[model samples]
Target: MPLSSLPAPTSSRRVLITGAASGLGLALARGLAERGDRVLATDVARARPDSVPAGVDYLPLDVRLDADWTSALAHVRDSWGGVDVLVNNAGVATGGRIDVATMDEWHRIVDINLLGVVRGCRTFTPLLKEQGRGHIVNVASLAGLVHAPGMASYNAVKAGVVAVSETLDHELAPHGIAVSVVCPAFFRTNLGASFAGADGDMEAAGKRLLERSRRSADEVAAIVISGIDARRDIILTDWDGRIAWRVKRFARPIYRLAMRRAGARIASTSHTIE
Candidate 1:
């Protein structure tokens, strides 16, 4: 089917989001539902009715498990016929340098952040193909594009998401499926809960991230929705992210130098960590 023949994704779309119990995912679920989109919000925990939008459906989903995704997709298929938008927004953050980071930590982070997105895309893509049109949005971080100290695993996985989304956008665009990757700076979210390793270090890093947050989850949610509506393949949340992206692209040596200095400063004396 041609793009011209596909249904317009407006208020009528069936939207599904991962990690919807709190933070950005919860905000997205509520934002979409409030705007009249049929929204299904899923996470490992059930969302409080007070937090979820009036008309939204909540589910328990462990994004690392394919079976969990299967059950959610089944529900959407049975109830709404098919989903028009899929959000791979579940992820974990582990704060440590490579020397301090453990293999177990790496595996856990990769399983949820990178492979999690891959699994979600692999599972629902066929349905999008069958339906002729749909959109997939993967939530990454500014860490992906900008390499920083003490976030080795996070940087790797999020970079993978950006790379994967770019490839998917081109490959699936021909099939009428739009793919986008959203890279946002630090935000006030529950990401701290997913931090791994030393509790003290993690707590410090988590607090720093929260303190650096320039926007709220609800604010990010609105930008995300607008990005998807525009079919933007690469979505940066703030002007700071935009500036860094440009510097990284146009002045590689300078960006690398800054990152190197940053890495050294954090390892040596800085209090904040990404």
Candidate 2:
């Protein structure tokens, strides 16, 4: 079926966002609301996050569960009529040497990071196709492109997200629905709160990197909005994100050397707890 035409950009768009309790998701929700969008913020938290403002609606959604998606979308249908944008921004980071990480750990990471995105895409795509003019944005990471040592699960899932987004871009463009992958460097977000398989050393390394980067979620949200406005297929945020994209594209040797050094650093961190 040919998709319905999109509503005006400046008008209120019925936007469904996952992981909207904190960090990038929350920031994006607020930003979208500020742009005259009726944003529905969903997260695992039963109570709404403080970062979310008064106007946006908050609903409990565990992206790891498929039933939760159906319920959330049902509410959207009931209240807002239908959705125009879907942001699959919910994810968790797990850091560890692949050998030290157990199967359970791998499953937890993959289920939330990669499969969560898949679930959101599958669940919402029909509604989007009916709408005709909708966009799906998947939040990936720079680690997806430039490998991050010790963050095996995080790196793997994010890379999968990138691949999914790229593939969807080609497939959905004909349907008038767009897909974008957001590749952001270490940003000032609590993205590391759900560390499942990472050791203390790996955790510490991640904290230090996040602190050093100090990029705010609001900053990244602005970039994301701009990317969506331009209908870009790949959205890069922060200086490191842009640099990594360029390096991966034009300077493979330099990117490889950097990855090697990063691996060495992670290896040097004495494993206190696995």
The local distance difference test score of each candidate is 0.83, 0.83
For model 2, the local distance difference test gives: 0.83
Clashes of each: 0, 1
Candidate 2 lDDT score at position 147 = 79
Model 2 stretches astray by more than 4 angstroms: 1-9
- Model 1: clashing residue pairs? none
Poorest stretch of ten by lDDT in candidate 1: 1-10
Q: Pull out the clashing pairs in model 2.
A: 3-132
Per-residue error at 99 for model 2, in Å? Answer: 2.2
Residues 9-96, model 2: lDDT tens digits: 6666788999998888988887888767899999998888777798999999999998999998799889978888899999887777
Error of 1 at 174 (Å): 1.4
lDDT of 1 at 27: 84
Give the top-scoring candidate (TM-score): 2
Model 2 TM-score is: 0.92
